[model samples]
Target: MKFEVGDKVVIQHSNDEGEVVEIINDKMVLVDVRGVKFPAYTDQLDFPYFKRFTEKKLFPAEKKPKKYIDQLPPEKPAPGKKKERIAQLADGVWLTFLPVFDSDEFGDDVVESLKIYLVNNSTLAFNFSYTLTYSGNSDFNLDGALPSMQDFYLHDIPFANLNDNPVFGCDFSLMTPDRKLAEHYEASLKLRAKQVFGRIEEIRKKGEATFSFKLFDEYPLRPYEEEKPVDTLGLGKLAGSGFRIYEASNGAAAYGVGEERA
Candidate 1:
């Protein structure tokens, strides 16, 4: 495959699309990727353009479904207030939590719901278990895998009956395709329960039914420890109260069967 100095191409290894800017030799060329230029090999590149079946069409095209949102956008941030940051659970997976309202089945009533989105922002793919706990109790749980550059909804909790629960905890455990634990992330969100209710109540008094809020602020994910291996002989000693001495196959000292030395 020959590439010219102005051909648009994608790097096979990184999948980063760029255009050829300079040709150094037959094997290498300088590619410009979003204003950044890097040397790439011709064998590690592919052209983004192809001949179309219709001669009248100049470019190739593919069909994709459109995404539709039913809820209204959240209110803008006040002056001097910064925008919330995106939360990263792992190297690539991002987590976001927001409150929203949707119409009921009858279309006559507005129902409160919480929206949880797990976005796979990197090329790595993995599965995860998501657990949401509040007020010392479990609220919602989900288990699934997210593909590259995809977003998933974890849950949509009904907010109308958050009577005694406001503070919430979230746990995410990531696993590879073979089901081994890769990483774990946990965080807490303490909503201004009373103030949130008060604001909603005031809005209700004005005869409005649907609303939304960027409820939780960004939180950081910390490293979590994995489970430790248990000691078999130590378990036996705790099962009974006696002094004994014994040796195991691995040449480690162990408690004997009811033999007293002291």
Candidate 2:
């Protein structure tokens, strides 16, 4: 029970080694284990000289070989080719919700949020405008061009937002270079809270990352129009009627009239 300052002692009933820093009384003394100091009874601590000598002789410490900078192993070269992104989505434009789970383990996983994506699975490029509304109020809006067979990340929606009745609307126009013009396709999706929960359950059961709804199977194209011959005469007659040609102005008005008729 005699513990003095600067004495290296082993705390009894444990392998903690500390140095006595102060003697509170004949029984309790302040001991510093590593950097932490605590009061301990003198009877609970003993000199570590015999224990240290016995351990050093019984279990000799193994010396590790010193590693030099020149002796270190060379780093391996990185791979030349990168992995390609691949997805086997159906041939349609899809609004996909990828659930981000709170836990990575299987079963009882909770969806933290959902990553929204506009997936263009068909062979058509489109300039798209997307909007998300909550409770009849616009919450998010994005505009971008989506390429064929690729997915565009819109934004993330918290899982709790499903209870507020969010509506996702998208308008798409073909990125065509031809003179033909088609009407912009508009699509909207609104899912109930129960429906979203059901989809989450289905995703968990199927071990899939995303639950998607098809927006459109095929992108609508402009109806084809038959080309007509240009009428060179101003006699108010059709070109196919074989009328005799007269003096006419071959300027912008002639081309404009032909285009308007076509």
Tell me the TM-score of each prediction against the true structure.
0.33, 0.51
Q: Where does candidate 1 have its weakest 10-residue lDDT segment?
A: 81-90
Cα lDDT tens digits, model 1, 1-262, are 8999889887675667888987755556667877655455578788765322223456657776764575556668877722112222343445554445455678643436545566555555556666666666776677787665555656666675465565544454444432333355555555555656675666458533223333222323343668888886585675566644444653343435455768
Q: Which candidate has the top score in TM-score?
A: 2
Q: Which parts of model 1 have CA positions greater than 4 angstroms off?
A: 1-94, 97-111, 166-170, 173-182, 194-262
How many steric clashes between backbone atoms does each model show? Answer: 2, 0
| Candidate 2 lDDT, 1-262, residue by residue in tens | 5767899999775668888997655546667777655456666777888677666756657999999999999999987731111224678999987666565466455777777888787878999999999999999999999988667879888888999999999999988744455668898999887998898888668644468888989877678889987746545564357854434675656457656452
- In angstroms, the error of model 2 at 36 is 53
Question: Residue 234's C-alpha lDDT in candidate 2?
Answer: 47
Candidate 2 vs. true structure, TM-score: 0.51
Model 2 CA lDDT for position 120: 83
